[model samples]
Target chain A: MKHLVLGGVRSGKSQFAERWIAEQRKQIVYIATSQVWDGSMAERIAKHQSYRPDHWHTIEEPITLADTLKKVASEQPESGVIVECCSLWLTNLLCAENEAQLTQEREQFLAVLENYPLPVILVSAEVGLGIMPINALARRYGDEIGVLNQRMAQICDQVTLVTAGLPMTLKATQGK
Target chain B: MKHLVLGGVRSGKSQFAERWIAEQRKQIVYIATSQVWDGSMAERIAKHQSYRPDHWHTIEEPITLADTLKKVASEQPESGVIVECCSLWLTNLLCAENEAQLTQEREQFLAVLENYPLPVILVSAEVGLGIMPINALARRYGDEIGVLNQRMAQICDQVTLVTAGLPMTLKATQGK
Candidate 1:
């Protein structure tokens, strides 16, 4: 079952995803896609690390998410995979300033996700539900994330939007 | 029916609200809360005006929404009202730099909405579902809007979040 969990910052999306993946499988492959660029980001990464169970295998990959997912699915067929978030992964790509890499990576990720044989849960930021940012990059980020979300929602068996620590299901398929 | 329609910029929120209100009542009162601050805003307002039906009564109110709502309810008891948005109204207050007016107006609007008569639909930007802004005022705006959305969701009969022109219900009462 492929599930997409989307929410705003500090909206309990990570917590929700943690509890959910724990329920799906005992051995979980926790994929962390964040890179510590600043002091605040380092602090946030540490905070997230503190809450996670020690037994779960954690892999920090800033890019090449598609390859990572494939390896996890093949290596541990019995375990469930949870991508902590796609937003930061996207940020990493956007900041790289490689348009070709961005396009290729996004397409590759989606193609890999189409028919994955595991209980995978993907988390992403719902950044489109806000006013347009003044910065050009921020605006571009919003547009890209919005399109990514819409595409992911199409493939995922269930799509949930979190707000104020509450989960609201946007789309759900039978026998999830 | 007191409904709140939440969405991002160009997320088809206004169109959704208009259609929803049209289904509820024939005599519609459109309350546009946008203030023309620049050329872009004026063009956007003009575009919105062109799309709306000429028969619908339009009121341009930048502040004192509670009083305007009261007057509308009293004068035309049969007509339904759709406030184009609360976010721009918030911007107006913030730009004015009058902290007292902001608090009083927000409190008053919520109070009036709690037991408002006739079918009314409010449109607001779901600005909290994004990254933390770099600017102090933008951050404050997000916080204020988040709090406002939570409060309004509590009092509203139905709350719908629009994304990519799709409507997803967050909260709904039995009758609404």
Candidate 2:
């Protein structure tokens, strides 16, 4: 089973995804894609860590997410892999890689996602709803994230959107 | 009937709101809260204008949304009013006012919304779903928009979130 969860900041998407994964009764492998670059982000990361159970395994990988996911899947094929978000991963790539590298990395990530054996639950931000970004970088970020989401939605078995602490399934079970 | 339409950029929120209002058979008054400050913004404004029907009344009021809505309501009591968005209005307020004035304006807007006589469809971006802004202004904008969306949802008879052009009702008319 594959699930893609999307929501805005503080909309309870992470909590909801955590709860859903917990219900799966499989070993949980949380792949956190956040790199704390500032004090506020460190706090946010700490807050997220506190919410997660101590028993669950966590992998903090800021880059090379697809490679990390592949390793995890190969080691624990039965376990459920939860990628906390795609936005941060994209951000890291945006800062670290050139355009060609980003395109290659994105493609690699998508391939890994398609071939992964475990039940994968991915969480990402729905970023395009706000006002047009004033600067070039923010605008580019928005466009990339939007496109990434659309691509993920196409491959995932279930796609759910969380808003104001409410979840609505956009796509369910492929056929049902 | 009051509806709160929430969506990310290009989620077709405005189109959904416009279609809903068109079905009402009442006079349609679009209160757009964007001021074209640059070429990109001007293009956006023009695109929005093109989507709107020629017969529908349009008001391009960047600030003073509550006052404009009130005046329109009194003059065209039978018309359905569509506020293009709340974020831009908030942007205008943030740019033009001190904290005290913003509070006063927000309060006044809420009061007016509460007593609004005609059917109203309010559109706003669900901006809180993404990353935490690094700067004070962006962070402040996120907090204000999230709070604003919550407040509006409470007053609205229907709250719908649009994702990839799909509209899902988060809250609907009670018992109806």
Candidate 3:
């Protein structure tokens, strides 16, 4: 079963995803997509790392997500993989300024996810609800993320939005 | 019934609120809280106006929301009121730089809404889901709106978060 978990910053999406993957009763593979660009980001990464169980196999893949997922699924068919977030992954691709790489990576990831073998959970930020940003890059980021989320939601068997640490399911496929 | 409708940009929240209010079978009072701050904002306001029905009584109250709501509830107890959004109203208050007025207005609005006589639907942008803004004002707005949404969700009989033109109920009081 594939799941897409969405939430705003500090919305407890990670915690919810952690709990959800644990419930799957499989060896957990936590894929961290965040790349620390500043002091605060570093601190946030540290905090997230502290919250995670040390025994869980953690893979920090800022890009090339599709390849990483394929490797994990093939190597450990019984593991439940959690892509800690897609928003940061998107940011990383955009910042690289490699248009071809970005397109290929996104398309490949979606293709791989559609027929993934293991129970995988993906986390993303729902960032399009506020006033449009004045910065051009910020606006572009918002548009890209919004479309990505819609596409991801379509593929996932279950989609949830987290707010105030509470889970609200958006879409669910029964008996999946 | 008091409902809080939360959504991201272009999340179809207003359309959902309009549909919900119409189902109530009461005369609709569309309280638009958007102010024309720029050319883009003016265009948005015009577009929203075009979508609304000609018969629905429309009131543009950017600030002074609590007083306006109180007046509407008392004078038109039988009518259903729709506050098109709280995000813009918060922006107006923050831009005005009046801390005391902001505190009083938010408090008054919540207090009045709790026991409001008529069926009321409140719309707001869930703007805290994305990357933290670099600008201080933007950061502050994010913080304020997050707190405000949590508070509104608590008071509302039903709370929904809209995404990609779909509604997900976050909280609901049974038979309410």
* Error at B17, model 1, angstroms: 7.5
Error of 3 at A146 (Å): 2.2
- CA-based DockQ, model 1: 0.24
Q: Please, what are the lDDT tens digits per residue for candidate 3 over residues A11-34?
A: 778888999998995589999999
Question: Which ranges in model 3 have alpha carbons more than 4 Å from their true place?
Answer: B1-125, B129-132, B140-168, B173-176
Q: Give candidate 1 misplaced runs (Cα > 4 Å).
A: B1-4, B9-124, B128-159, B163-166, B170-176
Worst 10 residues of 1 chain B by lDDT: B125-134
Report, for every candidate in turn, its global Cα lDDT versus the true structure. 0.89, 0.85, 0.88
Instruction: Tell me the tens digit of each residue's lDDT in model 2 across B7-42.
Output: 878899999999998887568999999987899999
Clash pairs, model 2 backbone: A8-B128, A8-B129, A9-B128, A9-B129, A9-B130, A128-B9, A129-B8, A129-B9
Q: Tens digits of per-residue lDDT for model 1 on B1-176?
A: 99999988666688889999999999999998998888867977998899889999999999989999999999999999999889888888888899999999999999999989889999998877555768999998998888998999999989998864558989999644
TM-scores for every predicted model: 0.62, 0.61, 0.61
| TM-score of candidate 2 chain B vs. the reference | 0.96
Full candidate order by DockQ, most accurate first: 1, 3, 2
DockQ of each: 0.24, 0.20, 0.22
Best by TM-score: 1
Candidate 1 vs 2: which has more TM-score: 1
